[model samples]
Target chain A: MDSIDKKLLNIMQKDFPLSSTPYKDLGEMLGISEEDVINRLGKYKKEGLIRKIGGIFNPRSLGYKSTLVALEVKEGKLEDTASFINRYQEVTHNYQRDHTFNLWFTLIAPSRERIKEIIDSVERLPGVRKCMNLPSVKMFKIGAYFSLDEEGEREEQKSDQ
Target chain B: MISDRDKKIIKHLQEDLPLDSRPFKNIAEKVGMEERELLKRIEEMKEEGMLRRLGAVVHHYQAGFAYNAMGCWRVPQEMIDEAGKKMSCYREVSHVYQRPSHPPHWPYNLFTMIHGHSREDCEGIAESMAEETGISEYTLIYSLREFKKTSMKYF
Candidate 1:
C-alpha cells in the first residue's frame, strides 16, 4: 500500500465519515477521486486486509454479555475441544495460546444464563479439565487501530534506493 | 432501548456497507427507508452509545502486526484503576480491561491486549508497561494459533 492508502486507513480507523457520500468525502480528504477510493478499498477487502467497513456496535449496549474463557483440555483433545466450542454461534474468537490453559475463546450471548449454559456444556467435555470465565468488570479501551506510517516509510525508502 | 425499525437498520449496518459511492442510499433502499432517515437513525444510535463507530476493521496480521499477546497483570484491587488507565495510554495496547481472577489456578485480574510487529516487540511493550505501572507480576499469553476470529452477530 502507498502513503495514500495508509492515510486513508488511519482516517477510517479513527472515524469514518457519517455523511451520505462518504466515499466522496474520503476522496476529497485524500485528494483522490471517489472511484479511486472505492477501488483501493475494494482491493483491500478482496485481499483479506479489510475485514469489513461497517458499524461496530457496543455489545453491552445491545444487551449482550461477553466473557473471555480459558480451558485446559487434555493433551490430545485440543482440536476436538476447539471444534466443539466453535459449534456455538456465540463463540466469536477462539485461540490456542502458549500456556497450561492453552485454549482461550470469547463468548457473547444475550443473557448471563446463556453464557453459563455454554460454559457448563464445555466443562462436561471429556478432555476439558478447567474453565475460567473472565468477564470484563471495567473496559478502559477497545479500539484496535494500527498505524501504517512505518510501513509507508519503509516503502518510500525502498523506492528511493 | 432500540426500536424494531432500529433493529432492522442495525441488521444491515452490522455487515459490510456497499462499496459504491452511494452506499447508504443502497442500504436505505433495501431497508425501505429514505437515505436521510437511515442516516438520522444511525446518528441517533451513535448519540445513544449503541453504535461505537462506523469504520474499517482491518486484519492486523495482514496489516503488519504479526505478533499479539494478552498481557495479564495481577494488580491489587486498589491500584486497578490507575494501572488500567496507564496501560490504556499506550498505542500498542489496543484493549485494557479488569476481569475477575480465579485464584490458585489463575490469579491475573487485569488484561491488556498488546500487538506488535514481532514477539520481542510485544514482550518489550509489556515490560515497559510493567515498569511504568510498577506492577511487575504479569504474564504475556501469546496466541500460538487462531482457531476462530469473527464479529458477533447481533440483531
Candidate 2:
C-alpha cells in the first residue's frame, strides 16, 4: 500500500460517488487517469488486500437484531463446536479467543425472537458447556479503518450516530 | 421497508464493484434503472441514513495487520462512557461496545477491538488503555481462528 493507494482508500472510505464512472471521479482528485485508478484497485482486489468495496448497511435500520455470544466448549471439541455454530447463516462472525469462554460469535437475525431461537439451538450443540449471550447495550463506534499515512495514526472516521 | 428494486440494487452493489470506468453503467442496466437514476437513488439512500460510507475493506492479514486484539474490560456501569471515550480515542481501537456482563463466568462489560501488526503492539495498546482508563480488570483476547465472517443479506 503506497501513498496513491492510501489516498484512494481515504477517498473510498469517505463516500464513494454514485456515478457511471466512479473510478474516474477518484482519478480526477488524484491527478491520474481513470484507467490507472481502476488498475491499482483491481490489483489490490486480486492481492486480497481489498475485501469489499461497497455500501455497508445499517443492520438495525434494516430490521435486523444482533448479539454477541460466548461459548465454553470442551478442549478437544472446540473445532467441531465452532463448525457446528458456523452452519447457522445467522452467525456472521465466529472467532476463538484465549479465555474460558473460548468461542465468540456474533449472530444477526430478523427479530429478537429469531435470535433467541438460534441461541436456544446453539446451546444444545455438543461440547458446548455454557453459553453467555452478551447483547450490545450501547454501540460507541461502528466503522473501522486503518490509516496508511506515515504518522501511523489511523484516520478518524465519523462515529455512528 | 426496502423496495424490490432497492434490494436488487443492494445485492449487486454489496459485492465487489466492477473495476471499470463505467462500473455503475452495468449495475444500472442490471437493476433496470437508468444510470443517472441509479446514482440518484444511492445518493438519496445516503441522505436517508440507510447506508453508511462506501469504502474498501482490506484483508488486514494481507495489509500487515495480523494481530486482532479484543480488549474486554470489567468497568463499572457508570465508568463505561469514560472508559469507552478514553480507549476509542486511540486510532488502533476500532469497535467499542457496551455488552452485558455475567458475573464470575463473564465480567467483561466493555469490549474494544484493537488492530496491530504484532502481538506486542496490540498488547501495548491494551496496556496503555488500561492504564489511562484505570480499568485494571481487563483481558486482551486475541483471535486464534476466524471460522465464519460474512455480511447479512436482508433480501
Q: What is the C-alpha RMSD of each candidate to the true structure, in Å?
A: 4.5, 2.1
Angstrom error of the Cα, residue A109, model 2: value is: 1.2
Q: Candidate 1, residue B46: CA error in Å?
A: 1.5
Model 1 regions more than 4 Å off: A150-161
Give Cα-based local distance difference scores for all models.
0.87, 0.83
Q: What i-RMS does every model get?
A: 5.3, 1.9
lDDT of 1 by residue, A1-161 (tens): 78899999877776688889999999999899999999999999999988999988889999898999999999999999999999999999999999999999999999999999999999999999999989989988777666568355211110000
Predicted model with the maximum DockQ = 2
For B2-108, candidate 2 gives per-residue lDDT tens digits of: 88998898888777777877888888999999999998898887788777666787677776677878889999988999998887787778788999999988789
CAPRI-style grade of the A/B interface in model 1? medium
CA-based DockQ, model 2? 0.71
Candidate with the greatest TM-score versus the true structure: 1
Pairs of residues clashing in candidate 1: none
Taking all chains together, the TM-score of candidate 2 against the true structure is 0.92
* Model 2: CA > 4 A from native: A150-161
- Residue-level lDDT of model 1, residues B1-155, one tens digit each, is 76788888889999999998788999999889999999998998988888887889888778767788999999999999999999888877878889999999888999988877678988998999999999999999988989999988897
